[model samples]
Target: MRRPSALRRLSLHRVMTHADYVSTHVVGRSLLVSIAAIAVIHAFGIVTMGVSSTSALASMLLAAGMLYAILAGLAVASMGDDLGQGYASLYLAHPLSRAEYFAAWMTAGPLVVLVAYLLSVAAPLIALNPSSMLDASVYLPVLCIAGQISFHTSVAVFSSILFKDKSKAILALLTVIIIAPTLVVFVGGLLASAIHTVDIMSLVAKIVGVFHPAVFYMPFTPRGGSASLSLAYGFGASLILYYLGYRFFKYRTDI
Candidate 1:
């Protein structure tokens, strides 16, 4: 006597609610601010430095990545506090699975970061010269930015879930802030040693070029070039961390 149609509709409705949780939390505000900041920087660079198309594009992408990483880090860190005691209790009580909640939280931060990337590059190009915007090179930078931000977001989410205590969470966030730059330096040194390049200055510059969020906004340097490998590494690391976080969240009680 009952129809399968109604059950399917209810299931779809539940899916929609879970997916929309991140958007409902206003994480997009961070992305909006990132866009505005990048636009201002682009405008200033053009006015002062006589920016070329390539330089402008690079700058925009760098600004977008840096801003999004910082903001997304902060947003994810405060997820628990923002939910409030009552809401947190209610969220735990809901029929939704822990994996679903974790996925939603993780997904929201990256989505905002992606939006920031688009706005950062698109707004500048639109304002300065729309005709020059369409190019294959542009996709490379965008992909790099997305991969970097995705990696950072995964770290932020994992840290958030791992540390429930406010003090501990803050410490974890600070560690993340510092470790990225340190890791880039170490990696650069290893690369330089392996290559045995005599040009110390060029080696130093190249070492600084690894696409970590900390030094992303630095001006033109050889180190900033050829980051596809670095980006891929970041993505791979993020996936590993995300999976580890999920397993821990499923069995652990302290979180």
Candidate 2:
């Protein structure tokens, strides 16, 4: 039999991605609640505190937190469940390869997160302060925030494939994103206290700043370069993890 053409395979992948989005739109609805919450909070700030760059930036980061917390695990749990339940085998039985299935999911999951994030942060901030649109400075932070969300999405997808179970994948993903960072800070604090010096906490904070998403919210600049270097790191690490997830899924995942 003739092999399927690359165009046909790509078309099938697109169709699969659309189907995943449709199926997961319920979860996407839940993301709307997050977006609404961000909008309401930002609106309240505008009413009471008035709009400022600080508040707008805070709201943007808040939206990123909400995006990571709400969608990360659930987005990829569907895939883990499919693998666990043998549903992936059904998909693989068709013209679709495992790589395409994985690609479809990776595309859909991030697409939902990105769209929800833009709605939650971008629309509200711009609407509240139309002048911000004229401000060239606003664009970089917005893109960086989106990049941060993409990083979280990659980690979540990798966790899902690694565990191959809904609950475990979600637990592991959240542990990495939230709990692990919190514990790092806590340890840093404890170490600083034990040493009777503030230096240890600063050192640990710097370490966390290197790897954790929490650092994205804070201000940091390396010796020579600007903060955009952090964005480069985030996107670069995400690509590595994304590929590792795909490799594992293609070679190791049974379904």
Candidate 3:
């Protein structure tokens, strides 16, 4: 089946290309398999590991941390070492337009990671305590991951486009994904709290609020801080980056 809405215009062939891209890559697939493996190991752990609040929380963090792998996979796997060689001639020569390529690559890129991440993180927590899903503390982390993944995917894709070299793109994606979140949530949030200046983190939080309809559950939000929205911001930021990346790849990438 074809993707819906705006993406419906993308041909079936393009969608298949995305599937092909995902199937052909080792990094994204391996990351997904590793996450699934963790869940599998936990599911079978009758004697070794026991589920508890701490273990559940650890799984949640592990799932959230999948954002790092998502970024890495999307940044490097989409090109399949094509971008690292310093040219897009092989892809550009294809029947696909640059826009089509980018859309498909992005449309299907992080989705794989998202599914694996959710299952990996949530499966363990649920197995440990089925009622945990009812707890905002448990669900909030999973919810936030959606937004976080989107944000990181866009960042990685943008980096991939910004730098033709694979390694450099991955580096840029990591810098922003790792450093930006800390600075925005921790540093910026802390500074805002100290001086009561502009709600630096709040502004970002407001954008991603959809990710966590209720914002106070996570540890990132200071006790008295402003809004800590995350999902909407992640989706919104991704949209902007996707546009920029596509535009650049479409016209300026001839270089």
Candidate 4:
């Protein structure tokens, strides 16, 4: 017999079923709510700040915080009700392969995050302060924020896949939330305290800040400043997480 075409192997029926399920699922609804929340929060910040020079900075930071919240919410929402287990089961039961299933999930999740971030942040910031648009500083923070979101989302997805239990996934997320800041502070604090100087803490703070989406969009640090370097570091960290996530998903069949 002639070899089945790629399309034939990935049956249209299976693809359609997956798409339908995703559309009807809470994931879609959660995405909508996240986007709306980001937009509303940023708009309020802009209005409250009164379109002043400082307001632009404040709005940018607010937008970044909203994006971080959305990303965290997405991870938590996916973990609730054993959604990841259900997704894995549905994909494995069908003609679809794990690779295809993962591809679809990764593609959809990041696109949602990116669109929501841009719509919530870039649109309003530019509208209120067009000059800020031309500043390299503005773009740098956005890049850092994007990197942070990607890295966190990847980690969350990997945790969901590996843990198999929704509660465990939630725990994983909470662990990250609780640990990251404290670790940063402790390390930075220790370095500064030991040296009897604030410079060491400032350096450590700048380094750790890159990994956080909320810190990236703050206007105090311009695009060409240390924040830019931190954003670059965030992108590099994100790549490593993506690779690890891919490896874990590729080899593990227990899901």
Candidate 5:
């Protein structure tokens, strides 16, 4: 029995190796450090440029989302290349199950990126010393940005494996990148519109606001409840995508 247990442990070791491959290859450690440097520069740019805080925050929000989405796309592209270029042949020849490999790959990308992003943001907050922007009300939804990134990353992983080509994988990622947010905003708007009868400007704000998360620590925004709903959708959708990815990977045949 102990001998069988030892064999099982040896077989399970591939999962960690798969995770290591993702951490080093999918998103390099140096790249994460460079992002931190960029964050520091962004803070300096904000201080010297006399940019309005609201506009600055909004720009950061959108930019972060776009940047993460692109990185996630690249990650999928890299993994798809691995599959397409026959790396998967050597990889799958081991005692490891495809499900184990997929689980490791799927989990590693989001976690490593999330850790990097958090480290990148921390330096900026410290160096900037802009106490004004620290208001929870203004930047509250920023907390959920990691979840949003993971959601995009999960979609990329699934689509990439299913398509089995880096180019097609990226295309699939882009399709979801465009369609998912639109759907989220539309659904959030429908919910928001049911509660408030507002004009074009207000309604438009409400619709856009649906993509932000609410801070339980602060008083409500004009559309705070919807913002909370948006946060839930963002995270909830990530969970769903991750499950779909895992299942697909478990059943997927090697290329």
Candidate 6:
């Protein structure tokens, strides 16, 4: 009986994992296109401008402006199948814990994002500029940019679990990335001016900055003065959000 039960548990894990992997097919194709596009950009730059068109600033801006939308979609695609498509009932009908299901989604979604960055972004950059791989000046910023993208991806995943709808999840992510911070700063500024306390706005801005973790590494050329602090905040916030999302998924009755 014990052996049979253990085997059943193992089988469920594989099933969940495979489902999550299959859901990433769209994201995988997008990443493949990105890789090809980046390579072409490099080739064009070499022929026309004497160097690769891609730079740390361009990469950071891309991550902040456009690439994040793709990554966020990837994040949502992994879990939306179960939550949005009513497959959660089928999966949960088994003796599987919700924790295991959540873990499988998290694992597969972010792994694809990381691999995408390596192949689509980093590899092409390095292919054209081999020496930069060894130069800390070059590689460190790239790694930091990747970190920023990963942080956003995690936030996107959290939003998907929170909203439980693919379209809303992506919308919420864009709001956090593009709108919330600006609004917070504006409101914070007004409150500070009214109270004659600049710290009020500063305090509010720092708190809101957690949602847009990529800002910490902006202007990736000079590098931020608070690189270590940015890493700490981004990593800490991601862990907190992940824990909250997992707990919500595990205990929520509606799902």
Highest-scoring model, lDDT: 2
Off by over 4 Å in 6: 1-21, 24-66, 74-81, 182-209, 220-224
Report the error of model 6 at residue 102, Å: 1.8
Model 5 RMSD in angstroms: 6.1
TM values, all candidates: 0.65, 0.77, 0.65, 0.73, 0.66, 0.67
Q: What is the C-alpha lDDT of each candidate?
A: 0.58, 0.63, 0.56, 0.58, 0.58, 0.58
Instruction: Please write out the lDDT profile of model 3 over residues 1-255, one tens digit for every residue.
Output: 955644456577866675566445634666545555654553444113434453445354544455445543554444535555644566557676666666556545666556655676566667667787787655655565555666666777777777776676666666665555445567655777777656666665643343332232244452332223444565666678778987877777754
* Model 2 poorest ten-residue lDDT run: 217-226
Candidate closer to the true structure by lDDT (higher is better), 3 or 4: 4
Can you write out model 1's per-residue Cα lDDT over 138-244, one digit (the tens) per residue? 55566666666666766776776676543455456555555555676577677767777465545454444443532332344424555556556567767877788
lDDT of 5 by residue, 55-121 (tens): 4554565466556556655665566777778887777787767766675665466555556555545
Which is better, 5 or 6, measured by TM-score?
Answer: 6
lDDT of 6 by residue, 1-255 (tens): 446433245555564665455444523556545544644453444334433434533454344334644554455544654577676777678765676666666555665555555554455446677775686544554555556556666677787777777777777667766678778888887888798735685567465657645445434324433555555666666677777887777777365
Please provide, for model 2 over 128-173, each residue's C-alpha lDDT reduced to its tens digit, 9 standing for 90 to 100: 7777756545555556566666777777788778877778877766
Clashing pairs in 1: 209-223
In candidate 5, which residue ranges exceed 4 Å CA deviation?
A: 1-13, 23-52, 126-135, 178-225
List clash counts for every candidate, in order. Answer: 1, 0, 9, 1, 0, 0
Where is model 1 more than 4 Å wrong at Cα? 1-51, 80-89, 123-136, 165-171, 178-224, 253-255
